[model samples]
Target chain A: MSLRRRDFLKLTAAGPVAFAAAATLPTSAHASPAPDNAFDDAYGVLVDTTFCIGCRKCEWGCNEANDVPRRARTEFDDKSVTTVHRRPDATAYTVVNQIAAPPETPQPVYAKVQCMHCNHPACASACIVGALRKQPEGPVTYDAWKCIGCRYCMVACPFQIPGYEYAKALQPRVMKCGFCAERIIKEGRKPACVENCPNEALTFGRRRELRSLAHQKAVASPGRYLDHLYGETEVGGTSWLYLTGVDFARADLPPLGSRPVPELTEKIQHGVFKNFVPPLALFGLLGLVMASQHSGENGGK
Target chain B: MSPTFRRLAWGIVVLSALHAPALRAQKVQTEAEQRSHMEMMKLDCRQCHTCESPTTTTPCLMACPRLTVAQSSGKHVVSEAPESMVLDKLADQYQGVQFDHKLHAGMAEMNTSCSTCHHFCPPGKIPACVSCHSIEANEQNLRQPSLKGAYHRQCMNCHREWSHDTDCNVCHLPVGKYAQAHDKTDPTDIMGKAHPVVVAPKMKSYVTPYAKGPVVTFYHEEHIELFGLRCVDCHQKENCSYCHDLSKPQAQKKTMEQVHSLCSSCHQNAKCSKCHDTVERPAFSHASTGWSVGRFHSRLECRACHPTGKRISKVNRDCTSCHGGWNQSNFRHAVTGLQLDETHASAECADCHENRHYNLKPTCAGCHDDKRDFKAVPPGKYVTVSRKR
Candidate 1:
């Protein structure tokens, strides 16, 4: 009875704690102490939902600016709100969302949705051929010929701006909004939509200027603004910024802080895989030991 | 035994003597027979020849009856070589063709003989095309390809394609004359009198054989102003063959009147006064009727003078055809305040007027800055400003 009890105690003591330590041994042996930095100038947009007016003037301007085909119904005089608002389709680079009208206010508030060309844009990073690239000024441009329609960019984009032409039998190209990059940068011309707006609503200027303008407009009009410049700090900064007077949370703008998106995943990834150095060193040591043991066995045989 | 042997020997000697001349004659006969035997028919050699020559004429010929008939048929056969039994055997292994008869015969003018294009055997026998056109092909005949390749080479070759002539009158007429001013090489002009072409007895059936004359008058001057016929209406500036054959009709199925009726059916409503108006017709309310036709002559009606919409012969370069007399001219309006300088006059008027639509306002504001919208603006200048601000 005494001998059996001693054997049982010894078995219990040797089991769990030793196994648990072995499980965590490799991780402790090669811990990455440094944080990674792949996102140099990753840019993005923060759409504040509070200040949108559903006037749809932005839509009209966007269509005109992009030289898109005329819609079957575009009567601006009608005030009926539809069950489904507009979406940014193949031709439209931007869309205006019509939120419920403010109390006692006759007109509804609207918000524009377009490419949130991201800082550390997944689309640019995913492009194997370097077809999609985020420029320093915040617009992502594409080289048509280099794209082979692998659709890796489509999967990579958070906003899902890049669309593929599955219907075209030949010579299909990836289509997306380039934020009027050609007109704004090279020709020094305002975007067509910005230029032809009947209302004093749309404006084209430097990103900083736009932020300041949005802030000033909101501050000056006390009841009019929700006191937020959407693209000022969210997801880094976007070339196209927005201003809204409604609750942004209700406007469907995703809640995100100033941290660039790629950093989140890269932090965990680089912490595990540290430039492949630790794993390679361990492999070399194991190989040396295994070789010596194998030779000894072979000699004995 | 000696006597018997002598008799036998004498008999043998007599027999040998008797047969020697006959053998020699036979050998000579055979040589002559080979030379005389009909072996081949060279079709191209007989293109200009009245009839096919017998194969005895050349040792290189492979005698064939089918080739003989084809060779005698004449130069018009498109396949310059004849089809024989040997050719039939080769055709079973490849593609066979009965080429167009007329075009190939046209090469007779080059004075080429059958050997120039045919496959001849060693020591001058007429070999089959397969013998020279196959994997064991010789270099001399290597350039001459298969039957299909040979035909394509001759027909689609760069040298044989028709192209536009760049000579002066060949494209544009001389100066102001609307119709072709002259055909320099015309045989009628060389004789100083038009001589009627002799209708060959064989070709008489093809000459003006159908009874039909041009149906529509197609008054050119009337259409230029009335129907608004541009220069391209009937006259094309490039590739004349692109529209009309100009050589000969491929079909005699339709009569001339049928063709004329078919063509003019679409253009029946197109006439003078349809687009332009005479003084008797309804006049435009704001049209300048009294303006002098400067540089353009004024005596004739619009349709009578410029019969064709196209600009015709050379006219005077000075801008005085109608404006020379100024206030005394038939036109009431004259250049009272200012006249266009050489540079302005030469510039196309439509460059500033925008499009050719007659409803155009014809003002500087169409392209240049609008002066009326803003105060303190010059009459002819424009100003750019933001509407929103």
Candidate 2:
């Protein structure tokens, strides 16, 4: 009744092979279908760069809401801070950068940088563990418990929005703008930044609606705005749209095509393993090899 | 049930379902037919419906975009429109904003056009903000703003110019606060609402922090009365925060360049000492610079003498600078309140006048000495001229 060394090895080998085989079984019917239109009703914010006066009230509001330590209210009035271009970091979820205006624009144009909250977020796709997720509502949220501190989301983001808690020794989380999901869904309030904007430069609404509004604004004021809306098509249409008088590139926004970041990788992945064929075949071969090893060992004994 | 009975029952149910829409259509057609002959003649069917043969089920009504420009007579718009309105759409968050419609209308007409506020007015009547914009935030169309946002945008457009502060309390009361907290009893009633008349200050003196020239005197009333400058001329692009909401953040210390931008159009910024004087300077007067704009010249525009970009001091003060070759024949002595008689008119030009400066009084000492002075022997008939200065 005692187990032999060879038998024990065979049992251990069979475990992974069997598990792989089971994982590869076809379940197309149960597979959740990709959404027909992910951004149909998702909330979005349209940021009109021309209207932003670089007041930095949004930054102050964000800090106050998120409980980040900041300087006094009077210190926020110092416009000299805008001289340097800044990126979102662990302390700041959003930062406004003043860009040199184009010839058409009368004054310096300011662009707010934050997570775009794309419909098909690359960060979600890049996360090996299900840490980063594109919520049904518009935010690309993070689950710190699931995160392994891989820093893949940071590299995957086209805007380089996600920041890692490199300083934390344990349980580091990826940080980015959450679009005030809790306030919007539970409290029924606007995002702190949107509420604090004096000029109403940022408009919060449904993604689909914001897209058309951005278009209409650009059309209505021919010379006032650049014809293109930044997030309308870039990286499969982000939730946070932008209207700028200058080219988006000049405003420190990355130039990206309309294709979603996950599209190319998903195509290659699905192509290699369509209908659960290739993975199933590999598992089958592994199982056969393990079975042959068990038989060969028995015959030798 | 028998098969034939079951079949007949199903047939009746199917027939009734099919006929329901047809019956409704017939009723609608009758209603359309019942229209008066004159009413039918007035409107073309295509005006409301897209198709030639529109029925109740497939009416194919055209969507009214409501983008047409509104036309209204100026007189009717003022008379028929309400004097004020209570914008209470966002009352849950803040008390209703009482808009003084008449005051704004009058101000807008004088400064801008009526179309500034009545942006989407149709013929005859002013349209409500909701006519174009939706009341609900979740409305499908995003082209126009929600009613709350539209109202704020319209009001802020002009309000921000006078007051830079965007504090909601400037126009609304906090949630639970009574409107009677202020002098006005009813916030909605604007019948007696009037902005306190803005009195022009005679002068404004600024003691600047500048180490060099610290005092700057701005002649406010003189610029309006004497210089004939409108309020908007210097107050262009001013925000409401400029006068209201003093608690708001003070404007940052202005640079020399920023300080000069205000009056650079009229005065030369290169001459900084002119404005930034060490001591509080007196109000600007034409006489302070040596040439006095007398009664006859008070009504003339500055450009008549200074011309474009010409310094005020650069103008010649002598009468001959403007009226060249002014001898007895062409001089029209009657304009001076004394018409010269034939005897004195034929005298040399320098006999009575000390210098060519018309501002100096004419003396007859050179011609007749103390024996027969200008008072003893009148030069001509005296004319009473009402001088404005």
For candidate 1 chain A, which ten residues in a row score worst on lDDT?
Answer: A33-42
In candidate 1, position B143 carries an lDDT of 23
DockQ per candidate, 2 decimals? 0.00, 0.10
Residues B1-389 of candidate 1 have per-residue lDDT tens digits of 69999999999999999999997887677565544332333334332224444333443433222223333212233354443222222232123333422322323212232323442322333545555444221223222334433332332221111321112221122232312333453342211222244232311111233224212233444455444554334433222122233342354586656744532544555553332232223323112544345332343455454455434333433334533542222332212222334443443445333443312443445445653421243223333332331
Interface RMSD to the true structure, each candidate = 34.7, 6.2
For each candidate, give its TM-score against the true structure: 0.34, 0.49
Which residue ranges in model 1 land beyond 4 Å of their true spot? A1-61, A64-83, A101-105, A266-301, B1-389
Task: Choose the strongest candidate by DockQ.
Answer: 2
Which pairs clash in the backbone of model 2?
B70-B121, B161-B238, B161-B239, B161-B240, B162-B239, B162-B240, B163-B239, B163-B240, B163-B241, B164-B241
Model 2: lDDT of residue A234:
81
User: How many angstroms is residue B290 displaced in model 1 relative to the true structure, after the best TM-score fit?
Assistant: 87
Model 2 reproduced share of reference interface contacts: 0.13
lDDT of 2 by residue, B172-289 (tens): 7656532333333346533245966556689999988776898888888877776667665666533333455455556688887787687786676566687788888877778877
